[model samples]
Target: MASPPCSAASNFDCGLEIKTRSVEQTLIPLVSQITTLINHKDRLKKTEKTLRAIQKVGQAVGVAVGRFVAVGEAIALENEELREEMGHACFEARRSGTAIAQLTDVCGVEQSAGVDRCTVFSDKMAMVKAARMLLSSVTKVLVLADRIVIKQITSSRSRVLVTLEQLERVSTFQEFVQIFSQFGNEMVEFAHLTGDRQNDLKDEKKRARMAAARAVLEKCTMMLLTASKTCLRHPDCESARINKDGVFQRMRLALEQVIEIVTDARPGAEPKALPISIYNGIQDFKARVEALRDCVYCVPCESLAVQLEALVEQTEDFTDSAYTSHEQRENVLQLCHATRQDTHNLVATFSQDQQSIKAREVSEAMELAILKTSHSVSELRRELHNVAVGRASELLKIHSDHAILQALKTAGEDGNLEKVADLARTLTEQREQLVETCRLLCHISGTEPLEITCIHAEETFHVIGPQIISAAQTFALHPNSKIARENLDVFCESWESQLGDMAVLLKEINDVFEGRRGDKRAYLSLPRPGKHSANLKTVKATKLDAEELSTIAKLGLELRLVTSDVDSELERWEDQNHDLARQCGSMARVVCSMALFTRGEGVLKTTLDLFHQAELLSEQGLQLCSLLQDFSTQLLDEERVLMVSEMEKLAVSCQQLQACAKTPVQGKSATFQKVDSCIQHTKGIMTVVASLLPLWHKLIRQCQSEHSSQASPQHWPDTQLSPPLKEDTLNGKGSNGFGVKSLEQHMASLTFLESK
Candidate 1:
């Protein structure tokens, strides 16, 4: 700074130049520096403009990039949501794009390049459409699954209620088992459908409900199975208690499971207890089961036991009576059947136990009692049947006796004395047989023989006694002279003989009936008698007491009146026979005298009278022959044949005598011959008649002997006359005046008598 001041005076001139030069140098540098500064300022202004533009461009690019990034993130998030919703449905929709590629082939697109390019845009479009369709389908599936779950839960609950009701109503072991088994099957099916996790359901609440329903069903099924097992093991009242307990436990478990499921479905919620109604229902069922068990143990057994004991006492008391009525017997049978039914019920109750020793013993005892009682009833029925049959037989015998007595009365009224005698003999034989039968029946049945004999005797007397007396009176009073008193005498003799025999037979039967033998047991144990032994013992032991003998004597006295009447009628018949014989002899004498006389008016009148008398005598002889013929027919012996022949000869002789009397004499010799023939024929007729009497008597005795040999009773009527004899009698053609066969011997006899 000092040098610049010195240069300012000497330096004014020198400093001026130095200043100028310094100015030049400084100006040049300033100018140069100014130019550089100007250029730097312009460049800095351009750089500032460029920086503003760059800033604006950077802000626009940043905004556009930010929008693109936001769109990409939104698209990615949408794709993730679609994947979660669609599942397999989206894949199925994408597979549909292959169809569009196939359609491009129809447009002439080649398989190499055009085919690959043709479906590119279409494939992307199809993928988006498929995604939307998959979402819709998934939404529908979730709705259907929720509905199914709700329905299944409701149905399961209803099924459980029905099963419980059925179980409560079950009466028998088989019924309980069947119901339990059905419930078990239903539970298994429900578990199979609900427990399956393969189905892709979206509703969380519905799935939880289905799970709870399945668990409850399973628990109920298990409880039912346990009850059935207990019943099978012990089929008694005690088993019912066990079954009820099991059901209660199952109900509790099922309720617990449902509560747990409900709590799980509702997050942050408490589990509630079962409803009051459901709890009350379970307790009610338990009480009902207990009541049924008590009734089974007490009611039926006690009532049945009391009834059976009463029936036993009644049956024992009934045995003391002498006779049991039909109503009483029927009541006993009903009691037995009721007792057996009660035993059967007891057996059914204890069937499951293998060691019911006391029950089996009681059943065996009841069976034995039933068998013994049945046998006793059967025996009583058999005895009653035998008695009924015997009574029927006695009635038949009485009818037969009445018929025979009627026949005897008819024959007597008709003046058929020989028929009357035959009927009397038949009646006697029948009575004897009846008495023998009564004796045999008494012996077999252990009845009173005297009682049976008395009944038979009473019947015989009532039926036959009056008939015999009436027949005898009718015969005696008959106006027919032809039925000579001699024939009646013979008939009375025959009746007397028959009646005597019947009386003897009845007495013998009574004696046998009264005789004492051994006890029934001893008699049955003895060996059976042979046929010969039986025949030999036909006369029974007669050890009757005084009273018995007196009774028999009284019965015998009843026949005495009949015998006395027969004798008196026989005496009257003998007188009548003598008168008839005298009248016949007078007629024969008159006929012989007429043959000796001339053929004048007076002689003719006498001959006519004699002829009328001969006719009367012939009619009487014919009546006698008819009676003898009846007796002969009854005899059925060789003597019967002889008697019949003789009677026919006598009838023929009578006819010859009438013919000779009726014929006119041609010469003196002829007239004498006729008279002699007439006399001889008459005598021949008388001889034949006399001969027939003895033959008739012999035949009657033969008939009686034949009837006595037969021991069995006559249960049916005898055969009527033979067909040939009936035909001959009805034809009205006379054979030797006998109304039967004509004999050549009779004609020869007539010729011989004429020749003599």
Candidate 2:
């Protein structure tokens, strides 16, 4: 019960845990193959089949090990700090793979059936040694690659700090503008880097802590921009200075927290990881239970029983929760009972194996019990997945319509305190539902990252509910105050943003369950545009009204759905690693993040970041449109015209957005008009994307079908074509594609507005 004697097999004793799921799971098949190679004679009689079996598994192992080392070597080239160690590990892996190949040669034995039973079995020792070496090397490589990831994050954080200091010390508006632009670029880089790291981390609490730190930096960034400008405008004002100082302080603290998490720099800073769920407990229990075959005398069967009981107790989380459906509760109970029975049978077989005649039949019986227990555990996990995914889906739909927020807004504006109070109660009830759902989700999310997202959602709802109430009180008290309404709108958007985040997280969880997850780049790719931060002293962005925010939120939701649709089509491509898929997937992620950013509580922090994202999106869109234009006659001319026209609209809108972001306007009316124009432009861009996404997907599928099966694509049946021929430069692979001037037109995003 104390511990399983520092198990080299369990502890993984490599000084690192593989936090990435792909790296961890990659070892499973190799392990199984090795086990088969060493124990083949036990299962198969000596013959030509046995020789072929050895050849088959040996070649597979060598090739797998070789490819695994290649990945490690590539990582080494990227991270100089880990290069030597990673290179050494990769070398060892390749050497061991060669050793495995030689050990299982069996070529001379193939020609003769009776090459001495001793010769056939003699090299098993060397084979085991080579397999161990190969496995160890592969693990070392994975761990080293993981270290490189951490190093990249630490290096990114250092860059942000350097810019942070410059931004804090700048005295002139021009100096601040230049430094903040660099700072924005750095922060975006840091955001993208840390976001990937955050998702890759296996520790749920660490992910949550990282999320919290990043959230602080994101909001403080927007605050920092305004606070610094205010201080520069009123050099003698203490409040402005204090506000600027506070933003700087929070930014630094968030920066520190992020690094501390990745590096565990501070003593005692490592938080306890999330409590091990029933799924993990069952895995450990089964491992210990299975160990009885070899180490029956050394193992304590009592501990196995205790661990099973603990797993069963953990299931009480699902069974006892009021939110759980009766059927799910019953199913969980049944699985728990089945697992207990299977475990009991396995332990009984273990006892019989120890006391009886050490017969092959008894050994076989114990194996059967182990397999059944494992199956029971698998069933339990599936049921848990269903429960979690189902509950999450229901909660998402229930919380989808933000009618309560709209009602609260209207009531506040109307000075109806009773209506506002009633809506607040309804919101409170909704918050409780979300919080409980989060707790249930954490138990069955199946991965640390998702569990963290669930916890974040819960906390968002918990923190923002009271803020919404407080803001509503202020709005009702001063119905005429624009600031009060804005405050309330901010809280409402925060709630909506959490909903949007939860939707994405749900899809991710489902994707993991279905085994459709791609590489790390696809995990969080932005490839965002970096722009000069402008001094906007004379051009305060006119705040979006309720109608505008509503439109933005609706657009956000639509973009998210379309991006999901694009992801599905991308998955259907024959070549998973195709450049076109990667490019489109990157654009999809940017759009997805843009969707969340538009929803208001996302990582973009300010309108400036939003404008920057929009320009980058149009740039990607034009590139995509060009690619489409170059495609064969699969696309009809009119459809081509539509795609090209929409892209042009997106481009022009980005152009207008860039101008609005840069130029200073004199009147509030002028500022409002300019801001409205920007919004309308963004709407046009969103509309283009929403309509074009399906066409792009259809075209890709058509191209794919043509390549493999030579099937004609589904074409548009309409003959009434729109007029064409404004430009012929929309070719996908043309050197003379949409020129650099258009790129320049959008490069002045968030400009340093200097009055001439």
Candidate 3:
């Protein structure tokens, strides 16, 4: 009853019509089983997510249909070996681009345009010989299907051998001709499941077929060292003779296949090996034989520096021809022995001053032969006073003939015999011209008149010539009484032997005028003393060591070593004007101290000691002006050594005055006599030309007063000066002075060394 009341509305409906057929059969089967369990749990949650997406699309359709049937049988056997290696890599890329365009048309470069390229290398070698005839049937079906598909590629066929190596790296050539037209239906189902796995080899697969035959013999030994550098950069290559016979016979069969693959990979323990390109081509032929032995040692070092520069120019011309023939045979034997010892002391002092001029020319020829015998005894006493004053007064006519015989006995007894024969024919023609003038005054006073002759002259007969001059004056007063008793015993024995030879030639001319008055007791009886001292002496008395003499007892020590080499070449030509005779003995001691300042009062102390010895000879002529300016600048730098020291002092003063006039004064050598009076006054022959002509004109006037006091810039300004220091002020009056063309070039080189 409670249950019947429980349906309040049911009861009210069942009560309303059995609750409308139990709510229509339990709500239409519970709303069709709750809409068929929500459409069967949304169709089992869309068939368990479409049966886990159709079981992951049947495991990705069995890995994409077993990787699209093993990449459609490895792209149908690599598209039949990539259509036979893409028609042999397009016929080896058109036969290596037509053999590199016929090696750039035989290397003259620029070719490849019209595409001839050896007709594209003969159409790429006929397409690489039809791709090597289909690469031997596609490498025997890819070596039994790539060795059973790379050993059953696990990860679901390694994506079909990685999609057949990405379809052979981008399949082409008409997709390898539609994959080699499906290579007989995928290479007979991949050669029936890759049976016999291509008969294994494996030593790492025979070291990868000997690393592809040592990488094709190291690419044919790098194309035979690039075809010997393309036959050395292609000398107009005929493809360089086909790259030297096909790349040097394919690099000598690729270096004999890299020496048979390094002798079959050197028993491959497998640590590492390779690298043998035929032992690196024998170390590149030993570095090209050491660069041809350094180019043959640089050709003998350039021919030994050109034969050592022609043997140093023939040893400097044979040492200048042996120093110019030993300085011209020692300057021609020192000017022929100091001009033969200064012309033998100027020919023995000019032959001792020509013996007082030959004794005054024999006392003027004996006073002109005693005035010609006193003019023949005054012309025989004026012809005996004209025969005793007028023909002996008519032959002493007995007082004029007794007044003419008492006037002719008073003229009656007749004195008219023809007028006394004309006065006895004028007294016998004046007594025969006075007996021929007394026979010419006894024949000109050679006094031979021992006879007075008046031959029978009838008119002159009584004139017996005065009894023949009284018997020739009684034989001329008897003068020949034995020549007056031998002329008083030879004039008392030749007047004491001519006054002892004129007192020994007046004591040798008073010891040469009292040794020129400096009389050291007139050179102490000088017969020879310190010979005219040009100094140089050496006398260790006595020596004879020509090997202790024996060469004929060392003929005077080989003639005193050959006259000491001719007196050392004659003292080198008497020291060639010995510095111009010591600058003319310091200008004759400044002209004898300016003639001792003109004597007496010692004029200003001998002119300040001769201007202090002429400023010490102008400082020794400016130190001999650097030795006469180094001997006049070595005679202007060797004007043949100052003309061989002035022809060796004029050939040794002419061989010492021709050997002192054929050698004389050896005079028992007491030695001295100023070397025989300087070899008899040869003052070194003209005292070196009178002391070099006034010491070269006072060294060119002291080098023109030192080049007119040297203030260069070609100094000019002359305004005439030089007449004896024209107002002398060189270093004063506004300093810079002395120009005038350097004192007129030192007075024109001191008038050219005073006219040389």
Local accuracy by lDDT, each model:
0.37, 0.63, 0.29
Candidate No. with top TM-score = 2
Winner on TM-score (1 vs 2): 2
Report the C-alpha lDDT of model 1 over 1-756, residue by residue, as the tens digit.
011112112122211222122223322322232122112222233343544443343333334323433443343355554334333433332332233223222222223444354221234344234323422332232332233444554466457557767766666544554464455445444444344421222233333333333323332332343343333333453423443454545454443344344223443565442222211222332233233223443334334334444434434323332233466556555654654454444434534222465532334444443344334333432333233224325534455335665565466557776776677677666554444433323322222322333333333333333334333434434524222232233333323333332343344433333454334221011123331232222222122222222222211221222222222222222232433334444444443333322211123233335344445556656665565555556655666677777878877776777676666544323333453454455545654543343233334445555676564223212222223222122111223233111111111121100000
**Cα displacement (Å) at residue 39, model 1:** 59
Report the lDDT of model 1 for residue 246: 43
Q: What's the residue-level lDDT of 460 in candidate 2?
A: 63
Worst 10 residues of 1 by lDDT: 747-756
lDDT of 3 by residue, 1-756 (tens): 011111132222111122122223322322221121112221233333443432332233223323323443544455564455334333332333233223212221124345454321234343233223222222223333343344442222233234333323332222322332232233223222221121122223232233232222222222222233223333343423343344334323422332332233343355243222211222232232222223332233223223323322322222233222454434433433432343233223323433574522324333333343334323323332232223223333333222322332222124233443444354345445444433322221211111111111111223332222221222223323222222222222222222222222223323332344243321022224445444445421222111111111112111212222222122222233455445535544443333223211123242123223333433343343345434454233444365446545644564554444333232223222212232222323333333244234333344445556664222112122224321121111112332121221121111000000
**Cα displacement (Å) at residue 729, model 2:** 43
Off by over 4 Å in 3: 1-583, 586-626, 629-631, 634-644, 647-677, 698-706, 709-756
TM-score per prediction, in order, is 0.18, 0.47, 0.14
lDDT of 3 at 671: 27
- Listed per model in order, the count of residue pairs whose N, CA or C atoms clash below 3 Å is 1, 6, 31
Of 2 and 3, the candidate ahead on lDDT is 2
